[model samples]
Target: MSSSSLPSSQKQVHLLKRPGRAPLSTEILNVVTAPLPDVSNLASGHVFLKTHFLSLDPSMRPSMDPSKKSYRPPAPLNETFWAGGVGTVIKSNHPEYKEGELVLSSAFGAQEYADMDVAATQRNGFFYKIDPAKGIEPREYLGGLWGTGLAAYLGMKEIAKVKKGDRVLVSGAAGATGGLAIQIARQLGASYIVGVAGGPGKAKYVVEELGADECIDYREANFEKQIASLSDRPEGGMDVYFDNVGGQTLDAALLAMNPNGRIACCGAISGYGGSYEGLKNSFVIVARRLTLQGYIAIGTFWPQDVYQAAIAQLATWLAEKKIATRFHFYEKVGVENFLDALKALFEGKNWGKMLLQVDPEWKGEGSKSAAK
Candidate 1:
């Protein structure tokens, strides 16, 4: 496609203002049209991309708050919100990149198009070229195969050091990373795996569909009792706890942990909506001698070899059908629905990895071939 034929303006979602303690609203995020990027003006090592899909994650909530301290910098007010997305390079001035090549980047804004500096993306440690021959869907890179999958792998293998015969418990078991963590624990030879999720349907999906040994509904009145009933091993408690919802669930898991247990604190979605339940059993960390560690999925935070090895192993497992991936996609949604899609995460409305399909016609390699 020639520059003259390309679009003059593109839709994008920008952070209009900082959200308060209440749930997110459209007032904080609004859709607007901006001038489309011109590849002819691209500097060296820069590429112009037409975004196809955008990833919606829980971590984005905290990043919107300038008061909150996190591994990543907060999103600036009145700017396009940062997100992980897959897009095709419409034009490129970089030697390493070419037009029509699909790539994944964490720097892509919640917009229809982007102008990327390839070297800067690499320097920030958040760029990947999607090879179509891999036989994996491009959106999977934003979910299980790359983003969420990598986080689960690093948390289990590196942070928790999960091993054979260990009793593993995963909180937020129906979410993207949580679901993958359950399967990863099973693959690592966990003798028993318990998944905690909200609603009966989600619990069933976690247990029956994801092959978890047991699933406990967090919304149940006897949530703690239900968890306690599952710790019937020789050690009398859980050996590994992969925590995604970190309020009372973390407290319950702490009470159910055996001596020398390991806890991988991946997220705290329960506390993201401006309220946090204090852990009543936090003293168990000292009494049980548990090792609790928090981690961020950014490449710079982890060793280079560890990241590559995990991705390689995850790719093999995916190809061999040992691990299954699921996505809850919003089809043909415009950038205006960005805040609504994000609200689904806190409300426990999404079944799996929540994603926005910016371009409904995109079909990965098929779309590329047809464009030719």
Candidate 2:
């Protein structure tokens, strides 16, 4: 195959290794530049795609390992690894999709191009068409308005049962989900909001930027005691706890929660390594008669229409500026530094949403035509 005769090739970061319980490394992934694959198997109703941005969450780590049992399918080894992102339809056979339309991607991976079966993806409630008229950035669909927002919103609304005058406490407050949870808690009419973060900077960001009433540094010595010492204590201690990092933080929250408090268990980031220290204060659940429910945003929790309605509400808040979002973008040239960004996430380097901005401007044949 001569270079000119061969199809246009693009970059795809593929799964190379599974780290298991070990630390993440660049060696776990390999960037492969390859020609587009034949999608003739899907005879019709397919479209060519060009991806713009992707969402990187700690949950993706579980997707890389076959034995890990993540919410999404295991990313294929030596094949393009997919992350939820936004893309453009270059050409389409599906009636709902068309040429030059932005879409919430279900199959478009880290690569520059994809052949998506639109009807098939929509059936799974993953593919959504973006209305450019709204003037929303592609990345916004991956942040507080997308799965990131849904997790925070639904967790607070359905599981945490946060109500007006509720004193809400959120762990991992500086992270995308936690950050949004704090803001959403305030918007939900929580009279007092407390964010628990690892360091002073993150704590400050939680209060000063995300609008939490107070942010406690969990790293401080006897931090649980500090949480217990907040002045002007409400009639009841934290009425709701939005838990992200489990283990010690969760234990601390248990000690400070009011009787009958509700706990929304969103994530157990500290326990992802399979070595989380057991919680020492779990007896409070029985003594206080608290409600604790663990959840993931997809499946039983989010019926397609319900999720859409929640996202629409969040969009309204975003437009009204009643709630806001901050993003940490790794805008390296063409997804080349995805591994670096993933490493940064694990190191707690990002203060908000961790996003990958790949190929913002690719001058490939038909690329610009498709994006516009």
Candidate 3:
């Protein structure tokens, strides 16, 4: 990994076909051996990179659908699949970049090597330089301090505007972003936080591990009743809600919010595969006078001053133990395993951040950073 030690060709994942409502399979994402980037003549603003870790997230699922209108374009057919990842600079033609520097970029195709134009990455939001001297781990960047944490920070701090004594509720409480939302709400001084998760085990994790006052199991028939009962409001409702899973959970949260409550609409995982008619309680927004706003992270939706300052605050909380985090690591062995990892995310199998070490030889657990 120190340099381009790759052979004549390397394995790569390509969008062979889009998985539109059908069951996911290897045929959708085909892996084939492809030649490495020609570092012989690197592009002007480009640097030759060796991917170390790839972030396997739910966001990738939407980009798979070419017909869907979203925050960005679909992954081009037959191209190296689009993804975010951390890597080492094997060689650099860019004046500002140097060999051996570790950086994270938004579109480091889910392959071993990518020729990145650092300027383009910077222009878009995160060509983030992982600072080893800051006492944060690189893998941590992939977890709580990067996109995931950034989402939680935006949802809880900026969008929801959670204040002291606010009774907050979070759906997808055991998953990566939801897990952090609980901790961030606590840091924001939420008096009593209730989490909505899929099952008993995840509910327990949300309560005991992630510091929620109580977590409701959505699998139960009376899950909505459970949410309604936790409200400390005079009308028996939550003051703020951070939504990740949208479907019945959103409907339930809608019925449980107090008048003028705030909701940070983050994701709709339950409806990602298209069957998401989960919000029957649309009238609740009108009935309760709620403020709900949807946003895209690592993008130009917010001002840089607000975004960067929030990111720094999250890192500070991570470093100061003001916040806690967990990561779910999956080593990239079979290209099919990456697909499985995505399935695990959609099925709520991951406990925290879901990541794939794209480099097969990297064996170290990221409790400590790769560089430090």
Candidate 4:
């Protein structure tokens, strides 16, 4: 559809307020109708876009709190929430971007439409053109191939330095990044791949579908025991630990690590909303001579060359069926449903990558039922 023919108003989910120690609520987000962006005034290297899917991730929860110190700035209150999304350009004035072209951007707001400046987007490090002929779905880019997948790839390959026959463990293994990280570990030739999740279903999916050798239910009282039981400790314990859930899980993984084991710290969702627990097993890191490294997928932390290399490899792996994509979709939901979808991340409700469909016409192939 053309920009001129599009609706004059669009729904937006704004950060109404920062949350307290409790889980996020509707009061923290304001869903309102806002003026559609005017693309008629063609600024050089700008495009008008209609968003299709907005990615829901645990990282977003911490970004909501202005007081929370992070690598990136927190979401400003009363502003349109920022997120990574896939969309199509309906109007364009850029040399590289054309109208009707599909694109992926990290700067798209939680709104139905956006006016993007390509030069500014590149300068801010947030835009990419999506090739429709690649046989990859737009939403997949928001998960394994582009979003969490890139993080998983970098965490495993670069940070953890995963090698052939290495025993690997990934926490939050049923979620987007963890799930893909398991598969990536397998591809990187992990002999014994162990996944840690919350329930039997997730554990089963992590093992049977995502190809983890074993999956431990973190909700079980014997969560640490299970990790020890499954890990090949004699072969230098778990060679690499890809940590997605921090706190107790990291502590447990630390206990199970072999001498000189490497840890790739991707996220700590366990302490997102001010709930944090000290790692009692941290002493083991020094005792075992373990290496722990924290990384961010974007910004100065990750090298641009490494990011590009990871993306190229991920695309090839995805196309060749070396890795699979799974998502827990919030289908046909409007901007008002944003906070609820986000809450699903912290609640351990989503089976895979959580996504919000802002475009009503975009039919998703994943589960329609919202995470309960």
Candidate 5:
């Protein structure tokens, strides 16, 4: 499919009601036809992009909640829901933005078109141009390169404040961010990289594919014992902990940190659906002088230097065959499938970043390519 044929309208996902006690319903959200928003009079700094891809993320689940201030605002009832998406500019009122430019933003109601104050919505810089001639795929921007990759790179390098020769432990090591965190730790000269993940296959892949020095299966009945057995002395304790899965995994890391160890609290995918029992090992922070830092990817705190550099390096890694990637594309489906895609994330059924292909150009087995 050529880019010219890509749909140019209000491509949107609608959420009917709150998911009460059970799982969110795919049937509840039905795409409705609405007039394409007129952006001719949009506020300055506001620009519109014809969305090509919509990122499916676990953090978005909390947005469905009716509560007001739980990280992000809840989706308004009976209205079109919003999300992070990448698109090409079909129209622009902002002076700096030109029509036909590609960009990414935190704007929601991820329809085929979006209008927002480009200055307010653009994170890590304005909608970046997507060079279609490059070997890298356009979808990568929504997944590893844009979403999870930035999460891992920023969480480890900046938030965790890692240093060479330090020992690092990563939880949820098979997922996109966790997997990338492992590699970044290794590249930063970590002495040993330990991975904690669910199931045997993930553990094996963490070691084999991600180059983890060791991997512990969290599903094993002797999970704690397995983690304990891998220890030795003062140096045996981890210097950095890159946490993606929370709950037990966090509790376990709190138990293993060396004095003055730092932790990058990226996400708690383990407790994604709802609250879980809080950590019992809270004492460790005081006992070990550990620093726990939490973050969301935005503002000056964002790892722009690391992110842009990594993208360039990632292309090289792919060319040199030093890095590998995997994706679980949920083929061309309608806006109503939003709940199903989100459910797959919370259930851990998805292996990498989940993305919705809103444009026909991205519907096939392969989409646009960037530099490899």
Candidate 6:
């Protein structure tokens, strides 16, 4: 039977064959034989989605490989890769969801549909309704307000306990979450925001484009010295360090943290190859009264006042153009480009959020007018 005619029970998924050193290519053909999904097994409030856009992020790499010493366990050897994604409703067995509505879910099976327990999925506690109105781009919901932006805002504002007049330092300052963290710091009235990126261009963009107070190129041999110099000019030493890259960048931030400073340890992308070593200045935390907290973006803070407050502020910022988002679109959605887009992330090739344009039913206002 044609895919269109196939019952919702027979969901065709793109499966991973095995782990390999070769980059993602069209020839990695391990995908076949997906079982049909049953939404009826899910609870009354639960809903299933037709997969639309799968998020490509740094955390996805470890989830793809079995042998890596990942912070989070990889998905079972031959199963689907689960992560954050937005999808449309194909069948709704629940009252909370209806046919054709879009919702975000963690069910990462690359099939057309997935069944999830309404209360249990997002069991780790983070999901939101995707509104298509309000003039905010659909992509922005995936990028700015939903996942990356939420991580950045929470890490800097809550976990790091950042205060006004504090000098905030963020490494990996050009990536999606890093860029968002920089803006949140500014919005929170941070006295100074310092960003460390891979190259001079990214460093310049961090300061000039992202509105950071200072930017340092971490590729420089004397990067620590530059940070020191910048530290001296303003409020010396960092009061809050929002780190995305671990390793040398982390080491330097540790050395430069002021007394009583706090660090929000979000990810260790530097150790993506699994070669992270002990810090040279591990004792700094004790000596400086520093609070370095490792953060995992999962918790029970659903519909909490803090979450609502942050969302409200972020929406206002976007509507007012006080906060802007940049994105690179991948026009197609097969496994070939899927792997290529992911590889580009590790190479630092994308300037902004990398999005795959699957099911191009909704375009901007121009397309809507033309269709009419």
- Between candidates 1 and 6, name the one with more favorable lDDT: 1
Candidate 1 residue-pair clash tally? 0
Of candidate 3, the 10-residue stretch with the lowest lDDT total is 363-372
Clashing residue pairs in candidate 2 are none
Q: Weakest 10 consecutive residues, lDDT, candidate 2?
A: 362-371
**Clash count list over all predictions:** 0, 0, 0, 0, 14, 1
- Residues 218-337 of candidate 2: C-alpha lDDT, one tens digit per residue: 889988787655423646688899999888888888877888999999988876655556878889899989899988885555676877788888999988888877888764646777
Score each candidate by Cα lDDT: 0.84, 0.78, 0.81, 0.83, 0.71, 0.70
In model 5, the runs with Cα more than 4 Å from the true position are 1-11, 27-30, 38-48, 66-69, 123-126, 133-136, 232-235, 300-325, 363-365, 368-372
Which stretches of candidate 6 lie above 4 Å from their native place?
1-48, 65-71, 115-117, 124-128, 232-235, 301-303, 360-372
Would you estimate the TM-scores of all the predictions? 0.94, 0.89, 0.94, 0.94, 0.82, 0.82
Instruction: Evaluate model 1: give its TM-score.
Output: 0.94
Give one digit per residue, the lDDT tens place, for model 4 in 210-276: 9988888999999887676544555567989999888888988988888899999999988888876
Off by over 4 Å in 1: 232-235, 365-372
Better of 1 and 2 by TM-score: 1
lDDT, candidate 2, residue 118? 76
Residue 26 local lDDT, model 4: 72
lDDT of 2 at 155: 92
lDDT of 1 at 239: 93
